[model samples]
Target: MAVTGISANRLELLQIANAVAQEKNIDREIVIEALEEAIQKGAKSRYGAHHDIRARIDPKTGELALTRHVTIVEDDWMPEDELEEFNDSAMVRLTDASKRDPEAVVGKEYVEDLPPFEFGRVQTQMARQVITGKVREAERANQYEEFKDRVGEIVNGTVKRVEYGNTIVDLGRGEGIMRRDQSIPREVFNIGDRIRTYIYDVRPEAKGPQIMLSRAHPGFMAKLFAQEVPEVYDGVIEIRAAARDAGSRAKMAVLSNDSSIDPVGACVGMRGSRVQAVVAELQGEKIDIIQWNPDEPTFIVNALAPAEVSKVVLDEEADRVEVVVPDEQLSLAIGRRGQNVRLASQLTGWQIDIITESQDSERRQREFSERTTLFQEALDVDEVIAQLLVTEGFATVEDLAFVDNYEVAEIEGFDEDTAEELQARARDFLERQAAILDAKRVELGVEDGVMAVPGVTGAIAVALGEGGVKTVEDLADLATDEIRGGYEMKNGERVKVPGVLESFNLAQEDAELLILQARVAAGWIDASELPQPPEPEYEEEGELAEGEYDPEAVFEDVAPEAAADDAEVAEGDLEPTRDA
Candidate 1:
C-alpha cells in the first residue's frame, strides 16, 4: 500500500503551500485555504460522517488545528411543534451552551479540540484529491484574470501541440488556443513551431479560460506594421485605418505628423523592406500602404491609387458616394472581382458606387428626366417649368413644399412671387398625395398601431400591411434581424430575403425607433410620456368585457399634439399649414 508523502513536521505545511502557489502562479492565501480544506476532508473521513469537523492552518506559524464545532442557537427562535427533532451535534440552545462556558452567546461557535490523527492510506488519498481539485480551480481563476484584458494584443508563443487544424500555443504564462478558422487562409502549423497571433477574445468557460487567437483579424496586420515600422510605434506615423481580406490581401491607410516624412514611404521602408516582412509572415499576402488625407474625396482618391477619378458626387445625407473614373481605368479602379473599390470603401468607411464617366453621364440624364416627369405631373407645370425645377434639385414634391422662400427664389429664373406660387402648388400636390396614400392605407388595411410608428411613412406602412404584419403585435413580434434582412430557406437552401424596411430605404436608427414604437403600441414595452396600450379586458362578476380592441382608446394617453406632429410630413416651423 502507498504511504502518505506529506512531511512529518507540521511547520513544513506552510513551506509546501508557498511552493505550490509559486509553481501554480496563484496566491499563497488560496493555497493555504486549499491545504486546510484538504486536511478537513481527511478529518471528515476519519471522524463520523455527521460530526462537524473543521481544520485551520495558521498564516504566520503554519500550525495545524483540528476540532469538532457546534453552533449555539436560541431555543425561542425555533417553532414549538418540531423542537424535539433538533440536531444535538450541530446546534445547542444558549441555555445549555452557557453551562460549558458562561460567556457563550447565541450564534457563537463552540469548539472541542481533538488529537492529531495518523495519515492512513484512505485519509491521505482523500486529502490529496481535495488539494489537487482546489489548487486547479484557483489556478484557472488566476490565469483568466492575467490575460482577459490582453485582447487585440500581439502575443508570441511556441506550438506545444497541434490537434488536427487547431494549435495550442504555450504563451509563457498560460496556453492560448488558435482555432483553424481564425488562422490566415492556407496557413499550416506544426508542433514546436513558434508563432505570433493577435488575441481576439478571452471567453470564460465553466471549466477554465478560453483564449482565442487570430491572425486573420484586421488588428493583427496593424500590430504587425507597428512592430516592423518604428515611426508607427513612436506616433510619428498614425495608422488611420486597416482592412484585411486575410492571406489574400490587406490595406492600411497612414498619416504622418511630420510634413517632411511621407507616411506611405515610411511604412514601405527602404525598397519595400518593412511591408515585405509583414507580407512574408502573412504567407505572401499583398499589402497596400496608402497616404491618408482628411478630405474624404482626396482620401478616396489616395485609397484607390493608380486609378484616376474623373468626378465624384457625394450624397451626405444618404452616406453614399458615386465615383466617376476614366472609362479606361474603370476595370483598374474596380479590381479583380471588385476588390480594389471594395477595400477603398472599407478604408474610407463609405458605401462607394463606382461608375465610368459615360455611365455617370447616362445616370444623370435618367435622373433629370425622372425628376422632370415627377414635377410636371405633381405640380401640373409645363415641361419647361418642370425641367427648371428638376435642374434646381427639387427631386420630390415634399422637397419643393418644404423649401425656404429664399432657396426657391435663388433658382435661376424664378422670382420670390414665382417661388411662392411654385411652393403653394407643391404643398397642394403633397396634400392630394397624402390623401391618396390614406386611401391606399385603408385599402391595404394597415392598423392605427402601425401608423403610430415614428419613422414609418405611409409607403412603409403599406409595405408592412401587404407583408401580412397589419397589427401592432405582429410588428412587435419581428426580430431586429427580421426587419433588416434575415435568412430564410428558398429552393431547398438557406438564403437572405430583403426586409420591408429595405424597400423603403429607412435609416437603421429610424428602423430601431419604429420597432420600439411598435413594441410600445403592443404594450410589450413602455417609454416615459409615450402612449401605452389599454389594460387587458377581464370579465367581471356581473358585466361582460369588450370583445374588440379600439386603438384610439388604447393610445388615449398620448398627447393630441404629439400624435399630430408625427402624422404631419414637416415638423414645427417647416409645416405647411396654409397653401404654401
Candidate 2:
C-alpha cells in the first residue's frame, strides 16, 4: 500500500509487491509487473498522453525506471491502429532521424530516461485502481489454475454466505457456489457452518472461474462411499451406477472384482455401519445398495428391489423393458409419485413400464383374441383353426404367407394338404391387402420411387404419403424421431408427436434403416457408403453350462422361423412384392 509515488524508497516497493503477492496468493513477478504498469500509466498522465512512456521495476532491488521512446519509421508508414493518427512525439520519420543521426535507421528506438516524480492526488488514485485491477486479474488466474483440474473431487469448506437460496462455499484457496437445485431439499447451511460438496464443474468466465459445487450429485454419494468403505477406495469393489431422488431415496449398483467378496454386503458393512456413515452425510437419505449384474434384465429386477418383480420382458431394440409384479406390489413398484420406477430406470439405463400380473394377463388375452380374429377373417377358417394358428404364434397374415409349408404341416392334427391350403389363403389375403394399400398410396400422391426403397412396402408407402412424405426425397429428409414417435416440448408441456410409421411399431433401428434406404434410393447417398452392421463379438468358450441362465437367452425363446416371420411382419404388414 506504500505505492505513493514512483520516487518511493526502493525497498518499500519490493516489500509492497511481496506483501500483495503473498496476501493474494499470486506470483511476486506478477505483482511487480502490475506495479510497473501502474507506474507507466501515472507517467503517461504526468508527461503527455501522446508520448510513448514505459516503466520497469528491477525484481531484486525494486528500482523503478521510467523512459520515453521514439521509434524511427518509414516516411510513408501508417499507424497499426486506424483510429490513431501519427504522433510526432512517439515516432520520427526515417529521413528526419537520419539527418539528426547519420546511423539512425527504421525500427530503431531512441530512449531518454526521465526523472521520477511524486504522485498527485488524482494520479495516486488512478495508480491504486490500476494496481488493484491487475492484482485481481492475477488472483483470478491463480484460482482458476488451482481448481480447474480438481473437478470431480470432494472438498470440505465453510458456508460463506447465501443469496437467493444459493450457498457460497469458502474453500481454503478458492470459493465455490452450490446452486439451489444442486443442494438437497430442506438442507440449510448458515454462515460459518462446515459443509462438504463435490466439484462437478469449474468454468472460467469474465467475472471469475465458476467453481460449481453440489451435494445432491450422484458422484458426491459415490465419493463418500469410497471414502468410508476401504474396499471401494482400494478398488476391490466398484460402484457401477448410482441414481438419486435426493433426500428421499437413492439406488446404487455395486460390483466386485474378487469373486469371494459380496459387493452389496461389503457396502452395507456390519450393522450397516459403512452405509450409515454415507447416509448420515446425505441427511439420512435412504440408500439401496444392490449388486450389479451383467445381465440387463436381472440388473433391472434388482434395481426394483423390495417390490418383487414377477417377470421382465425386454425389447432390446427399443431399450425398453416391461416388468410385471403382483397386484399388491404395484404401488410399491411405482413408488410414491413414481420415484421408485424413475430411479430404477435411471440406474439401469432402460425405459421401464411396470404392470401388475392381472394387467399382463389381460394384455396377453387381448392380443390372442385379436390375432385369432385376424386369422379367422383373413383365411376363412373356423374359430378352432384360427385359435390354433394364434396359439402357435402366427402374429400376422404376412407370417403365415411366408412360413415354410413343412413347418405349418408339422402342427398337431394337420397334414401337408391343410398346410398348403392355409398358406394359399394367407398369400391371397396379403395380395388383396397390398392392392388396397397400393390404391390408397396412389390416392395420397405417393411416388413410385418411394416403393423402390429396399424396406418400403405398400402399407408403409401409404402411411408415409398420409404423413405428407410422398416422395423419396421427402422421406430421406425426415429424421428418425419423425419416423419413430417421440415427445416434444410445446408451450411448456410435453406433447406426443406421432411418427409416420408409429402404427407399424418399428424399432428405432428399423426406423433408421428405412430413412437410410430412402436416402440411397433418392441418390442422396450411395448404397455402398451405407454403414454395415457390426460383426458379432465372439465370446470366450466354456462360459455356459447346461441349464445355466444366459442373458442372451431372452431372445432365444422365439424360434428362428418365428423370429424371421415377426421381423418380416414388422417391416410391413403387407407381403414383399416388386409390384407397387
> What is the number of backbone collisions in each predicted candidate, taken in the order shown?
0, 0
Least accurate stretch of 10 residues (summed lDDT) in model 1?
547-556
- For candidate 2, the lDDT comes to 0.87
Query: 1-580, model 2: which lDDT tens digit per residue?
Result: 5368888889989999999989999999988988998889889999988999999999998788899999999999987897978889999999999988999989999999999999888888888889899988988898899999999899999999999999999999889999999999999999999999999999999899899999999999999999999999999999999999999899999999999999999999999999999999999999999988887777888999978987787877788888889999999999999999999999999999999988877777777778878998999876566766776667889889999999887766566777788899999999999999999999999999999998899989999999999999999999999998899999999999999999999987788888998899888899997779889999888864422234332222223232233211112122212212
| TM-score against native, each model | 0.80, 0.86
Candidate 2's C-alpha runs over 4 A off are: 74-87, 101-106, 403-406, 409-421, 476-499, 505-532, 538-580
In candidate 1, list every pair of residues with a backbone clash.
none
Q: Kindly give the stretch of ten consecutive residues in candidate 2 with the minimal lDDT sum.
A: 567-576
Best by TM-score: 2
Number of the top-ranking candidate, with lDDT as the measure: 2
Writing each residue's lDDT as its tens digit, candidate 1 over 240-305 gives 898888888788999999999899999999999999999998999999888887767777777787
lDDT for predicted candidate 1 compared with the true structure: 0.78
Give model 2's TM-score versus the native structure.
Answer: 0.86
